[model samples]
Target: MAWSYRKRIKLIPGVHLNLSKSGISTSIGVRGASITVGKSGTFLNTSLPVLGLHNRQRLSGPEPPSDPTSSPSDRILPLNQSRGNIFSSDVQEITSQNMQGVKEVLLLAHQQRKELNSDLLKTKASLGGSKVKLVISYLLIYGLIKRSIPEQIKSDIESQKEAIAQLQQAVEDSYVAFEIDFDQELKERYQKLVDSFIQLTGCAKIWDVTGAHHQDRKTTRSSASRLVEKREVRFSLKSLPEVKLGFDALCFQNANGADLYIYPSFVIMYSSKTNFAVIGLDELSLSQSYVRFVERDAIPRDTKIIDKTWAKVNKNGSPDKRFKGNHQIPVVRYGELILNTTTGLNEQYQLSNYEFTEAFGNAFRDYQAAIRGTKQR
Candidate 1:
């Protein structure tokens, strides 16, 4: 009988494999192996040596030393597409199947990871060059995680902008005006305005926007009644310097105290230097705030409105005088006694919810759409 010798077989144009006993072992390497040279060209896996895949050797001499200085891990190996550190005919067959989409790459990478962990638990893997393949698998997974992230985020943001524009227009179409007598109809209108303001601004309470730390109404009355009189309702975005201001006073925690020209159906707000008004309107009413317009714009930033002649004065200049039997409260107040929404407003700059909403909505809608449009791309 003749002794048989295994010969290297050419599988394809560039891929060749040795059928010898040790060839398969060296080709795959063990798990947790160090990273090796990148694959040739753009092929998924690195090349191996049956075909002398990499012509350039790391050694400088014609022959390798009897005792090599390099560790097994230091010797680079080909990256296998499968796990188990053994690339058999089965693995090759599985990879040949039609595969597409993002998860395909991730699934194979994750499978290989599980195989490596299984080997670790069983202590069957020395992992030397195998780690290099694991690294490639993880790299594929990492790439998939970030896929379409930036674009999807941009799409979500763009959708929100359109929602805002439509919401503003809807509010404008719903605005209703009122005169002196504050009735249930007026109250409903006021409530709707408050609702839309809360929904769009994300301020669940006045403090969320105003940063007011008052716990109860008594504390609120003491702190907030005089708040607008002081500079608490000033253009400063928030009561606390640490917090950012909202788009308008309605969004502020102390919406009643904010230095804005408020009304039952709408409020007009603007920067100190600009004549343009940013109007907040009732989504339930379709008109102007006719009862009266507040004129804080005419009042100085730190001025106070004296409605009652308090007999007592504190060091802080607050009058503690209560209304007596003969001496009644002042004709006007912006507090609980009345539903007046015109305090501190700029009457001269007042506009019906009708006039302002359409214009403001039109102008702002385009600007927002354009801004988000740039982000979408």
Candidate 2:
């Protein structure tokens, strides 16, 4: 006869086992008594019919159809009491396996997280470094521009200074060789020419008829007919490549301080053959004496050449009643030459427009030379 015992084990929530022994026979089955192991361990029984029957009872139960949908917790809860009867070592082994699996999964997840964090930190540092580089590059460019600005300004200022120096030198050179006393000669020559022209023309004069009839007629006639004449002329003399005489003298005031004069440095003479003739003086011969005359007397007197012309008076009035005398002739002062004629006398001269044009052209040509490259002193 043999004896048998049954045992049950629970592994986690989803697994279970039932073990039975009878004589020399052994078997294992699930909760529904479907045997998965049979005759494998101590289940061969030749005697002990009671133990065999008990074993058979332990193995026998209602047929268990496969339950593909049964949950592991549903299977496990029914075997909770049976688990106590199983080997503690086997239960501990199953629990350890589950715990090891969980730990491995958690550790893998933790390793992945640490790797991600490291990658994020590296990316952030790279971005920060790039930003720092960009800032430094901008600062370097700005510094270069700031350093260049002063040099550019200095170059511009230096160029301007050079231009100013050149202009100053040109002015000084133009005046360097000029003579001091040339204006005096010009004044004397101009006066002589004026006197000669006036006498040669034998122009009419205005006399007060009242003076002829007065008891003091002798003195009055003598004084009135004395023919006080004042003449002034100014012209430029810069067109001629070469000039013989320079400005001689500038007559600025008369003995009575009522007359003013300006010396001519240019002249134009009209003749039947040439039609127009131009004379020019050397700029190198213009004197400080002439400048003095302008400064001291002539400029202060504010005398103008137009005031001396016969055109100052009316043609229709008697000598005594009019503000200016009758017998007033019209004089066209062109450059240094005085064109003296009565209003109708110019018609007889038959001077062509081309002749006047040529004379004015020549005068302007010389005038340009005197002013060019020269400053007013």
User: What tens digits encode model 1's per-residue C-alpha lDDT throughout 302-364?
Assistant: 223444422233335354445243232221121100011111221111112222322332332
In Å, residue 222's CA in model 1 sits off its true spot by: 15
Error of 1 at 276 (Å): 28
TM-score of each model, in listed order = 0.15, 0.18
Model 1 stretches with alpha carbons more than 4 Å out? 1-377
lDDT of 2 by residue, 1-377 (tens): 11111211111111111221110111212132111111122132323221111111121212221222333222321111232221111211221211232222223333433443453354345445545544564576863556554344344344333333332332222110112232343334345544433332232211111111112323332211112122222222222111112433222111111111122432222221112222222111111000000111122121222312222222322233334453343222111111111110010011112223234323322332332322222
> What C-alpha lDDT values do all the predictions have?
0.25, 0.24
Candidate 2: 10-residue stretch with minimal lDDT: 287-296
